[model samples]
Target: MQADSDPVTSGMIRRLLRLVLGSKGYDLPFKSDTDRNFLLLLVALMSFLAVLACAGTLTLHAMTQRWSSGLENKITIEVKAETPNGEILSPESVKLDTEKIAGMLEGNLAIKSYQVMNEVEIKKLVSPWIGEDFSFDEIPMPGLIAVELSAATPETLETLTQKVLSVAPSARIETHREWLQDILRFVKTLQGLAFLVAMIVVVTTITAISSGVRSRMAIYRNQVEILHLIGAPDPYIARQFQWHAVIVSLLGSVIGTAAGLAVATLIFHLSGKDETALIPEIGLNYGQIAAFIILPLLACLISGTTARFTVLRTLSQMP
Candidate 1:
């Protein structure tokens, strides 16, 4: 009965004191206002860098998927203007060879669809490198045919290439498989680097909190000794410092996350206005957004744990 009513009696006393003292309340003096503000700024900076790294990783991953999907199961065939007799073929002969290759591709079971590009289309493709005002009639340009395959397999590709070569000996096939592999490898490397950076930032934050706790312990050594003499336990004293660290880190992380998100939003808005911009859309799916939202709480947890451990270790070393 005494243990059951103890909590109720303490609650009533706290309420009475609150009523008499208005806003006055008891709090530990582990950190001054300046100390807290500085910690908050430090945490905010760390959080901002972390958020940027996370967002960049997500964006790069999205880009990799988009690029791979767009290029998958796609191949291009170019019919050069040359004959088997080591003589230059005329434009008319090139067109005939291109049509023959397209007809063969259309009959192939592996090809889903094929289109032979017209002279105007071929000219437009080369206009970027050669001046837009250049004429295609004076120069003999190879014809381009884009083919989409239903089943992308090595055997199917080899068969299709052999069939095209049989029809047009000068035709060459290009597949994006090698290029895509290179791009995927690069993206994976970047993601790994981003993760490493975020871990470093977390470690730095923990070290900063641990240092602050040690500094505070030295400054309040006399007060801590008195508390110990009065029979205060290490855990009870540690809670005060731990809670302070949590509050400071939480506030800073919130501010930093908000700032990072705001910058991302602005960039997305601007990028959306330009259709040709290479910047991938800055939209996070639900899972990614949830992860970002939890980052601040994670920072607080790290700070609190660091403080608790530092305080306990310091107290253990005391005589």
Candidate 2:
């Protein structure tokens, strides 16, 4: 009971809560700063960009994970439209080539299943390029075989490559694993870049707040010196700037967050993707949405701390 009733403990708890939750009081004349609204706008803009950077990083990781899982054990065998000598093959030759590849796949125990696309399916695949209205029957199209494997091991790839070359000399084997790995590497680099951008935004925010604190201190330098002469400590003065910073940060973050969400939603809606498409949809799950709320709180915390430290450091130098 004595510990709980200690004046020092009670004072500390009140200060900590005031620092975190803020209060409606300002010792320094913050209203006199004509450019304070501009400061809020700048913070809001930076916060908006930071939100986008974080969301982009998350979305990219989700996309790459989806692509990696869906493509890892899959491979494609592309039978060329022309022979090695560059002469176009007849439909019969292409059909025979697919049959030979299918037989080879059946022989390999590693192959879980394989499907040779029919002429209609092949035409449909190329519909985006040549148009669905085109009715040409003699067009030489490269045959594609969709192959799924039980395991896409290195030995499986090597053995399959050799068998494919022996059977169809002009065919190309595209192991999705190889290309997917490259894509994952690229995505990771992009994620790193996004993280770097987020860090830059944070630094920018801190710098802006520090500059504002300095300017505010300068504006109220007379009042601050008199407060010091009357024996007011630095923390006593620090709370003034801290509470104002928290208020501005909270208001700015609210606007920034709403704008960021609107823009993200607009981009996602305009992407023209559907459930049938292989492209991963851009969205935030409940967890991601909840995580997003932390961004504003973080901004407020950073703003308050920066303002507090800047005010304390500046005030300590006053004579």
Task: Using TM-score, give the best candidate's number.
Answer: 1
Give the per-residue lDDT of model 1 (tens digit) for 108-198.
7888988889878888788867867866667778889998999788998889889889998899998988978987998899999999999
TM-score of 2: 0.82
Superposed by TM-score, candidate 1 places the C-alpha of residue 234 at a distance from the truth, in angstroms, of 1.6
Locate the minimum summed-lDDT window of 10 residues in model 2. 1-10
Error of 2 at 189 (Å): 5.3
What candidate 1 gets wrong by more than 4 Å, as runs, is 1-27, 31-33, 83-87, 278-282, 285-287
Clashes of 1: 0
Q: How high is each candidate's TM-score?
A: 0.85, 0.82
- lDDT string for model 2 (1-319, tens) is 1223333323443354457546533556565455557667877898889878888898898898888888889999999879888898886787788789888898689999899988788888889788887654557887789998999999998999899889988789888766678889989999999999999999999999999889888888899888888998889889878877877777678778778877876776666467657567777666886787888899999999999999989987887
Each model's lDDT: 0.79, 0.80
